[model samples]
Target: MKRISAVIVNWNDKETLARCIRSLQQQTHGDIEIIVSDNASSDGSQAMVKEQFHETFLIENPDNLGFGTAVNRGFERASGDYLIFLNNDLEFAPDSFAILVDALESVPGIGAVIPKILYSQKQNAINSLGVNIHCTGIAYPRMLDEPDCDDLAPEEVACGGIFMMRREVYEELGGFDEDLFLYHEDHDLSWRIRLAGWRLLTNPRAVFHHRYHFNKGKMKYYHSEKNRLHLLLKYLELKSLVLLAPPLLLVELAQWAHSLMHGWFFLKLKSYGDLLDLLPRILVKRRRLQSRRAVADREIARLFSSDLQISGVQSLALDFFLNPLLKAYWLWIRRYL
Candidate 1:
């Protein structure tokens, strides 16, 4: 049997981490090595892992190195054929790892597999099957906060928090983009994986429970907006950009309007400023990624979803006004790709 290394990056969330560790210990797949990569958490998370889950490997960083970097640290130490990147705020079903591994191994050219994630408290509500990115570079889980829809198909991106990937593929792709730090890292990595001619799958047989919560803070909005724009600037082909320019501009306008209305105008402006400052460096990375792309821009374009799914109270103005326009614009431009 192939060994599986599960890495969980955590910061100041010890109680949930303990629950996550317990679930991993109960996995049916016995050759699993669990590693807890703590980001200098001050909540005694490191001590809990050291004492309570003594069998699990623990990496205590000197400071908070962010999610992607800390996970990379765990990836370097991993000796398994497959790697499972999981969030500390989750509980895996006994066969979750087994199911994901089986799906990945059975498929040709599949680099990763994500399980159906349901809310820990609301079992009937789906957290995510996987992830998808909109044409405007908004990454989201379609089933987030929605009742189970039974839509179990392959996805454009794997959910960031919990997914399994082949070790060799991950290494070849250089793992997650650390610059993203928190948000859209999965979308960016999965986009690269697809560009490298590897398919991603969603396995319904596998299951996990997430204690998911949507953050409304300025930092959350800032990283999301900034990284999304960064993703587009880096990977979106110039031709596609030319064709989609009008809609993209409109999306930006709408974003600005929404932010202003919601009192996040300054944060939104900060994201744009940061994006401008990082443009040159992002372009360099773009050249590197584009040079390595095994697929055409059009092929990558197909993976993006037409609709953007946001998890929060639905805005009547957005639903009745903005979304229809956005959907129509996407459908029109997608054919060109």
Candidate 2:
């Protein structure tokens, strides 16, 4: 029998951490090993897990290493045929992990499985169905904040917050890019795994509740934009990059204007500057990715959208003007690639 390992990376969120652990304890899958990778929380999250969840394997770090690093640390200690990475702020339905495990086990070439995630505060609202990549190299969670429905199907990439992967595949792919630090780490991993000929799946029958918030600030924008650019730098094939460069520049200009309006202009600049500093390492990683690529650029391009569809981010003016132009440009470039 294939054993399951659940890894939860936590920080200062004690209440949510305990709640998440309790939900994991309720999983229908029997004797699953749970590992808590606590990132030096000041709120006693480590002690809470130790006292209340004695069965859990705990690794309390001395200092806060970012999300990707902590997750990597947890995976290093895991001993299961299938591994799950869960957020401390999530609560899984009793059968969620069982369903996910079944899906991956039954499917050939599936690298990971993500559960349908709905907002805990508002049951009708979705936190993520799966991720959708854009032509300009941005990735957004599909159906976010949309009314939850049972009609959605499997997608190209799993939701980062709630997902499971085959242990061997995860190790072979080198797991999450710790260089990403936090944001867009999933996309980087997903893209690489897909390139290496593995599919990411979604199991609608498996569901979880996420305590999500819009919570945006300059630092968030900085990491998101910075890591997004890093994803493009590290994975995009040469042909795709050349094809998408013009539109990417246009998008960058729009982003600069938006950031200026929101007093994040300096942060945006800092992201660009950071990318420049990180170029050498990015190029080395890109070479390795390109050399191992199994999927062609054309196939990957088919999965990318030319226009942003998520609400609040899309404007009537952008849809009316920018979106059309981007779509037309993508149509042109994608054909030749």
Candidate 3:
């Protein structure tokens, strides 16, 4: 039996942590170990886990270290053949871990395998089947709102946050990039895994329910914009970057304008400004990432689909502006390209 370590990162989510752990305890797979990394939550999250789940390996950080760093800490302590980085707000089905373990073990070259994630609030709705990226390096969960629970075959990517992977691969790729702080680290790792010639997969038979958002605010948007650009600079070659620039610029401009219209001007400015502020760091990291590149541009481009490319910009425009502007922008992209 292969030993698996499930690493769950927690912030101030005291309310959801118990349920998450309960679901883990119910896993039929007995060879699993639970590692909880707490980010110095003031809300007694650490105490609750310590008092209740004695089997869980708890790593307490003195300060609120970001998600990427916390998970990396967990990786250092994980002693399993397989490592699973899961969110604190997610509840796994009884066989979720077993199925993921089976998938990774069954496939020879697969570096990682993710299960179908459903919404905890809307049980029928899907959270992520598989993650897809665009030429611009924007990544999103495929089939975000889709209801179908069909089984999906193994496919390739670089890294996924809620996925299982061989411990060797995690060490070889150097684990998640702590610089990411919170968002887009998964994409960065996944991209690196693919470039290193390892396959990342999704197993539909395994399932987990995610709370999705126990907290809501502009912080998410800020981290999102900051991280998206970070990954783009870190992964894409100059040629692909040049090709993707126009669409990305257009999308950013539309987002800025929409933010102003919605009286979120400061939030919009902050998002772009965060990117600018970290420009030096991003460039330095990009050079470092490029040095480790194994896969070529042709291989990376094959991972993206045409529909995925258009949909990202389309969704952004629709979310910020009205539906009419989205249609117009979509039409413009179609005509110009």
Candidate 4:
């Protein structure tokens, strides 16, 4: 039996971390190791873990390293053949780890697996079954707030908040891009995984309950918008990028207009500014990734979903008009890819 390690990243969310730890401890898989990577949380979470769950390996960082970095740090000390990266605010079903591990081992080419995630407050409703990306680089959670279903197919991106991957896969991929820090880290990593010809599957037999609520946070907007553009520049082949330029520009305009109305115009502008600053470094990394890509851009483009599934933010024009147009555009340009 392959041992599994759960690396839970936390920052000031002590109570939620406790619940997450308890759930992990309840896993039916006895060889599972629990690793708590605290990001310099001031909420006395370190002491709580040391006193209450001292058996669990704990890494108390001196400063608040970002989410991906902290998880990577915890993983450095992990001793299991399989690794589960997770947020602090989640509860795993008793058999979740078992189900995920079984799926990973049973599949031949799968690189990672994420369980169906349901909303903690509304357990009957689905939170995510991993993430999906649009051709324009927009990534959103699949099945957000929708009724739970048993569609256990493969996905474009594993939900970064919680998922299991083999130790070799994690190490080979070089772990999460620390620059992503919070948002879209999963999309970036999963995209690379797909580019390397590894399929990602979501196993319905396992479930994770997440305490998630959507809010229009400024910092959230910052990283999400910036990292998305970064992905476009880094992953998409130049030919594909040129072909998609018009729609991409239109999306930017729409975002600018939407941001102006919603009090986030500066953030929209700032994301572009930040993208410019990071361009040279990003393109260098792009060359590295592009050279390693085993899958063609056109083949990979098929993984992108046509439907737009942004959560919590609603707009009449967006819902009724823009989405269909974008879908049409994707359908048309995708043939070219």
Question: Per-residue lDDT tens digits of candidate 4, residues 1-337?
Answer: 8999889989998899999999998999989899999999998899999989978999998898888889899999999999988888889889989999998998899888878899899858988887878887888887777887666565545334367888888888899887666788778878877888887888877988889878678778778889989888999999999999987887787778877887888888888888898888898989999899899888888768888756556888888988999898888988887
Error of 4 at 115 (Å): 0.5
Better of 1 and 2 by TM-score: 2
Greater lDDT among 2 and 3 belongs to 2
TM-score-best of 1 and 4: 4
Residue 317 in candidate 1 has what lDDT?
A: 63
Which regions of candidate 3 fall more than 4 Å away from where they truly are?
157-161, 214-216, 308-337
Candidate 4 segments exceeding 4 Å error: 149-161
Candidate 1 colliding pairs: none
Q: Write the per-residue lDDT of candidate 2 for residues 201-266, one digit (tens) a residue.
A: 888779899988775767888898899889888878787788889988988887887788888999
Candidate 2 wrongly placed segments (more than 4 Å): 155-161, 309-314
lDDT of 1 at 319: 79
* Model 3 per-residue lDDT tens digits across residues 216-318: 3556656776788788777778876665666677667765765566556687678677778788887887787688778876776666633333232446445
lDDT of 2 at 153: 79
In lDDT terms, which candidate is top?
Answer: 4
For all candidates, the clash counts are 0, 0, 2, 0
Q: What range of 10 consecutive residues in model 3 has the weakest lDDT sum?
A: 305-314
